[model samples]
Structure formats: C-alpha cells, structure tokens
Target: MAPVTNGRVLFNAIPEDYPVPGKTVVYDTTETIDFENVPLNGGILIKVLLLSLDPYMRGRLRAPEIESYMPAFPLGEPLTGGGIGVVLRSENDAVKAGTHVRGWLAHQQYYIAPNLSMLEVIDRDSKLDWSVYIGAAGMPGETAFAGWREYSEAKKGEVAFITTGAGPVGSMVIQIAKQDGVKVIASAGSEEKVKFMREIGADVVFNYKTTDVREVLKKEGPIDIYWDNVGGDTLDAAMEFAAKHSRFIECGQISGYNQGYQPMKNPGLIFAKCMHFHGFLLAVLRPKHSAAFQAEVVPKLVSGEYKFTEDISHGLDKVGDVLLAIQKGTNKGKAIVRVADE
Candidate 1:
C-alpha cells in the first residue's frame, strides 16, 4: 500500500470574468485520508488516477442561480467531476479496496469520498484502455449514444450534422451515425479538426472559422439531424440549413461559455422549420438507459466498433492549464489530467 500523507485539493475559488493570467487554481491540504470515521457512513477512500476536464465544469464555477443543471462550486472547497481511480480503502461491501472505479471525484491526488452512488467498477480485462472509461466508453460515449437515440431518433440513410466534430463525443457520434448508414456533415474550428473529422467517417467536414457554414450545409443538402456542440453562431447557421421536421440535439454550448453568456440570435429559425430542439444532459439518461448502454455499447467498444481519442496531460498540477487549453480549443479530443501513474 502507498504511504498516506496530507492530500492536496485544488479549487478555483473565484470565478474569472475573463481570461486571467497565471495560476488561477487554489490548493489546500486535508488532515485525514480516511472518511470511514466521518458522519457519512459506508464511504470509500480513493487514490485518483485520472480526472476529466470538460466544458460543463466551466458552468459549475459560476453562480448556482445562473444554471439549473448543477450547483456552483462553493468557496474554500475542492471541485468535483468525472474521474477514474482505485479504491485505497472501503467501508462498503459493494466497493472493495484495490478495485478500479470511475465517478465524480475532487480535483486532488487523494480524497475520502463519502457517497459515490454514481461510481462503477471498471472491468480490468476489457481489452480496452482504462482512460477510455473517462472518454469514449464512459460519459462522453454514453452521451453520444443517448443523445442520438433520444433527440435525433436517427434513421438509416439520414443526414446528420455534428458541431465540434473532432472532439471525443462528436467523433464518436459521427462514427456511430455512419455505421447506421447516416451521412455525416461535421464542423470544426480549425482545418486540422475538419480533416480529422473526415478521417473519422464524416461524409462532409468544414472548418466553421474558415469556410462558410451555411454554404457548406447548402451543398450537403437538407440535414435530418444536427448534433450541436459548439453553439452560438454555428448553431444559428446550422438552423438555416435544417430540413423540415429535423431534430436538433443541443449537446453543448461551448461557443458562449467564454463570453459568460450570449443571447440566441436565431430562435425564430427553429419555429419556422418546425425543427425539434432537444437539450440533453447525460446524467438524465443514466437512470433509464445505463444497463442498455453498457450491454450494447460496451461490448462493441471491445471489438473496436466504436473509437475514441484523448488529449492526455501529465500530472495533477497542470489541471488548470489543461482546462484553459480545452476552453481555448487547443487540446485535441477529450482533455484528461493524469493525476497518478497506473
């Protein structure tokens, strides 16, 4: 067993109004590594290996009233999100020591978790990389599946458009949609990402920053589904090209995140086309579809029917920089912080 010591917990205490220079992360030390003695009963102690840096985390740093999905990160405490870790110790029969699991964990090297009902034990012999659990095989993978199935109801031979096409979830969505005989039109911020999108099965890929999104969509013809990731102007442009009775899956609004918030410029387009715009959160699908997703998608992942990409950053100290990079569209695929070596 690794020697226990006071663990460091990192948090962004003050929300940044705009891009701030230098270390924005604040660190604190905890006395006990064991939460078994805490008032919350049957908790486990986790030695974290990987932590996910996602766009949704940006919303968490803001005031709670501004967003209804998740609570704001409180002052003087560690922020939590999806992570993969090993159970160092456990007070629950379901969770045993040394078991590999993934769930929401604080941004720290080690922490005593009180309740982890969302946690799942990872299969070590699954023939897939463990990091994929936090990427393709994990929430992002599940999100793509659920979002497509629920929002799009995508059928064979339909045309699907996914924004932020080269990222983990967008790439997976493109692959899955293509396999179903759906033609995919994907948009990215850069030419490299646009090229990567085509490499990953996008029927038509365009760099929104460089190319005319509406013109490209016009050339592609009427799209049946739009899996939106980068919202704002991109979403507005996509709306102009959406087919009648088309489904618009609002996955993430990454474009407006840095601006604090931006008003939708083309709300009228949705009504004119009678397009169905469904906003999705992955957590909502967990209760009803977790079993099906695991049974159907997990096995296929092992056989390589589904693929994922990751932009791994070494060390826990670089968490802030990595997150900023993701926001700035610098990191490729899913941005993951490797907290400890396997």
Candidate 2:
C-alpha cells in the first residue's frame, strides 16, 4: 500500500575469526523498493518474514579469495541465504501478492525475487509455520534425511553418535535414528542443549562442556555411525572407537567454520577403523529427496512425535548478532530472526 524502504545486512568485511557485528556484518538501510516497479524485468517484490541463521553461513563470512563449496560473500554486497518471505507485489502470473515463499533471500525487510524457479511458493493452506521452511522442514531437514538414509545406511539396533545434537540437523538425525530403531548418543556444548537432546529422543546424551569427550565417547561408543557436526577433538574421539565398517557422515563442522581449519589429533583412525567418511551437499538431493523428507518427517513434527524448539530474535537489525551467536554455538535451538509478520 505504501512505498517500502528495505533494510539489509551487508557483508562489510571478512572476519579473521568470529563475526563482529557492525564490523564484519554491518547493518545498513537501502533505497526503497517501489512496489509498482518490477524487479528482474518481471520478478516479484517480497517482504522477508523470518531469516534462518545457519552454521553454513559462517563459511561465507570468509574473504573472497578463499575457495569453498560455495563462493564467499562478496565484499560490500547484501548478504544472501535461505529466508522465508511473502510476496508483496508480483509481475508474473505464477506469483501474486500475499503468497508465501521459501528461497535465497537477503537478510532484509524486503527484496526482489528475480526468479520464482529458485523459490518454492509455499502452500498457504498448510498449517505449517512460515519459519519452519527455514529450519527443520527446510534444508537442514533434508540434510538429515540424506545424511542418515542415503549416505550412512545405518541399520536398526545400531549405535550412532551425533555432535552438536541440539541444532536442527543433528536433532533430526537423533529423531530419524530413533524412528528407525537405532540407538543414538548425542553430545552438546551446554547442560540446556544436553537436556534438549534427551527430550528429542537421544538415548544417551553428554555435555561436552563438562565431560572428557574422548573418554566418554570411547566408553559409550563402539558407534556404527558418527553424524558429525562439530569437528575437532569430538571427531578424534568418534574415530577412536568407530565400529568396523561404520559410516561417518561429515556434515557441518561449526567448530572450525569461524576459526581456521583445526586438524584432528588422530586422523590416522580413518584407516585403522575402516570408516567411510564422506562429505555431502544436501542441495544435490533437492526436489527428489525433498518429498520423502516431508512425507516422513512433517507428520512426526505435527503429531508431536518429533519435538523441536526455535530461538527467534525480533527485527531485521539483529541479523548480524544472531549469526554471531550461531557461530559461537550459543543459540539453544534454531537461531532465527523474525523480520516481519506473515
């Protein structure tokens, strides 16, 4: 109804270590997006509702010269990643005002979606919350599905260990394992997260903050699968007692994302344990495996069989701070910023 002045977070500089708000992740306002004007020739204007703050985003905070699976966030550009948005105005027949969408959107109050192909116009009739698309029901959920089902091939009655167990992906791994009758040992940084892991059906949970990770893991684990999220000493311990022919799903390594690559103290166990360690991209399995993930997990979520929690901070201005908290592993659940109301 009125002209919209969008506010967005910009990738100001590459952080040498953890992101420093206003320095590495700067908050800046931008020119108002004219609702009457079409973006990307015939694209739509969207009002971002919820912004997903994920661990993978930390990798993009690096300097541009360094190469990774995805390109580093370019200097002085608006930061972009997965976000939940609502169409404000549309130029295409397929999209219209008031439609909910999930896609790669800037950490801004409003942005232009140049292509609907990169986005999924969510079924408005569904009872699911818009924020769910950015968290467990989104990429992280798909990651858990592919990691445990397609990659790990873990069987019932097997023992598995998941690091950073309170986070979305790791939590899903715990639920999926239990659903398939596998025993899961979950580890997290704090007492609160440890409790969350247990609530989400982790058979055994450990607080890495207090426990000797190596000793505890070696004692509780002859683990058949290690769904790794944090890499460093935790990985070393998983390696030490890995069961024969065990699968190690190398997921997000949050511990090393901010700090430079920290080598494992006992990488030699890869050979001695005969473990299958492979990294994977969930994007590779999109559309095909997406349905299976929804069909399998969404019902459980709705039925309260699969419990989850979300930590939402209000406003678009806090995008940088939330990302910082996610990097530090302080957010108890899915770290998200609610930018606008749906």
Candidate 3:
C-alpha cells in the first residue's frame, strides 16, 4: 500500500475587511490525509465529489478568537461547508460504502467525518443530479424553503419582493413563492440574471444595478412580504415600501458578508407600519425542513417542474477562485466545485 495524500484548501489568514485569494485562502497540493486512521466511533470516510459554495460560508472565515452562530474556520486548517460525496468506508451502520451523502465535509478530496450525526445519506431513488444535493436540492433549497415557510408566511395572492433574486437561495425563494400563488417582484444584479428571474416565474424582474430599486418597488409593490438576501441599501429601500402589517424575512445580507455586518438605517419601518421582521439563517431550519424537502421538493426537482441553476467549476485548485467569484456575484445561481465526476 502507498501513502496517500489529499489536496485541500486551507483557511490561511482572517481578513481585515475583505478576503484576498492568496492571503486568505491557501491551496495545498499534498496535504497528508491518512486513510488508515479512520473514524473511531460511528463515523464515515467521505470521498467528496461536489462541493457547494454559499455566501454563509464567508461569515465562517473570521478569526478563531471570535464566536458566532457558526464556528469560524481555523487558520491553517481545511475549510468546511455543505458538499456532496460518496462514502468509501464507514463505522456507522446508517451509512455504507457507496452511499451518496451530503454534509459539512471539508475542502478536500477525502475526509473522515467523525460525526455521522452531521452527515446525511442521499435518497437513492430521488433521481436528482449529484450537484443538486449541494445546490438547489440541498442547503440553498432548504434555506429558501425554510425562510418562506417560517418567516415570510405570506398568503396566496400577496405581492412578494425578494432581493438578490438571481442567486441560489433567492431564486428558489422566487419559485417557491410563485408556487404558493404569490406575485413576486425580484431584484438581480445583471440583465442576464434579471431574465433568469423572469424565466423562473418572477412576475417582475428588475436589474437593481441599473434601476432605482426603491422607485421600482414603489411602482410595482406595496409589498406584502419581503425576502431580503443582500441587505445594505436595498433593505433600506424595501423598508420604505413595505406594506402595513407586512412580513420581512431577513434571510441573508451578502453585501455585508465581506464588509462585516452593517446597520439598517430605516429599521423604524418595523414600528411605524406595525410590520414583522425576522432575522433568519438556514442552519437550524435545515433539520426541520430536511424531511419535507426530500418528500415535497425533491420530486418537483426531479420532474423538472422546478428548475435550478449552478455554476460549477472543476477541481480542488479552483476552490478559492470559485468562492471569491461567488462573493463577487460573478457566478450565477449556486456556485459549486466539481471535485470529481460521478
């Protein structure tokens, strides 16, 4: 037997304000990953096939000393996020060799996930593409699902507004709301993305980059529900036009992901209009939606009734660039790293 080595992307330095590829992310060509040293308890060794890069992972790149809802990526260690893989070996009876799985697997070719509780085996008969588990059918799908089901509980026929509507989560949010009979007005960064939003059933899609989002929302909506993805100025504008007794799901603030959290200047809208606002993250919501998502959402995904977009770049070496591109909104839909072929 030969000594095995795994390539991985490590979190090198915590950014002061923004992440620089060479400075914040370091790619190691020959990181040692001893295959013989398997998980001691009910664990599994995952052969990572596809990895999803979502904006939430950016928040996890903080210094070790800081504490937040999610643990920060430690310096000089492999970065971990939601990804799809196949089990190569397992001490856990729940998972077996060749089982397709999804979990917080590291940015590596092979990883021993010591905690089986954190990993989930994909449904064998679901007929979804492997990358879908990490993209539309996975966390991003669940995030959009949970946000609407929980926070933005707008009834059918309501006018819904979604920010960053072309991104994975927001795009799903747009579709889900449409399915529920809501008339959706969504915002995207580019014309291509705006077209994508309309293609996915958004009633009106505006290019927030060129259009006055505030003016458009005012003209198109006295919005009943607002699902915000990029918070900053867009949120401020949404607040002005939010309908009385409306619901606001604060799903993400990607604009502030690299710049650090920014304060909402027009928060007084909550009190003035008697509106409801909820700060949301899908981490906890995932478990609650996992069963329903598989039962309800997976079928639609497989049937092509519901569509998803993913920008997949190949190889372990491209992880840093892929992530940076996602943060920059250069990639459309869900950003995935195709580490291996199915």
**Which has the greatest TM-score?**
2
Identify the superior model by lDDT, candidate 2 or candidate 3. Answer: 3
**Could you tell me which residue pairs clash in candidate 1?**
none
Model 2 agreement with the true structure over 155-257: per-residue lDDT tens digits: 8898999988899899988898998888899998899999999998899898988988777766777999999898877787888878988899999777788
**Which model scores highest in lDDT?**
3
User: Which parts of model 2 are misplaced by more than 4 Å?
Assistant: 38-40, 124-127
**Residue 20 Cα positional deviation in candidate 1, in Å, after optimal superposition:** 4.1
lDDT of 3 by residue, 1-342 (tens): 454778899999887766777778888976666666644566788889998887778888897678887889988999998888988888888888888888788999988888677777775445767888777788888988987888877788899999888888888898889989999999988899998998999998999889999789879988999998888888888888889999989887888989866788877778999999888777778767778888887788888888888898999888888778878888977899988876
Angstrom error at residue 146, model 2: 1.8
Query: How does candidate 2 fare on TM-score?
Result: 0.96
lDDT of 1 by residue, 22-51 (tens): 345654554444434433357887889999
Cα error of candidate 2 at position 264, Å: 2.9
Whichever of 1 and 3 has more TM-score, that candidate is 3
lDDT of 2: 0.84
**Candidate 3 local Cα displacement, residue 72, angstroms:** 1.2
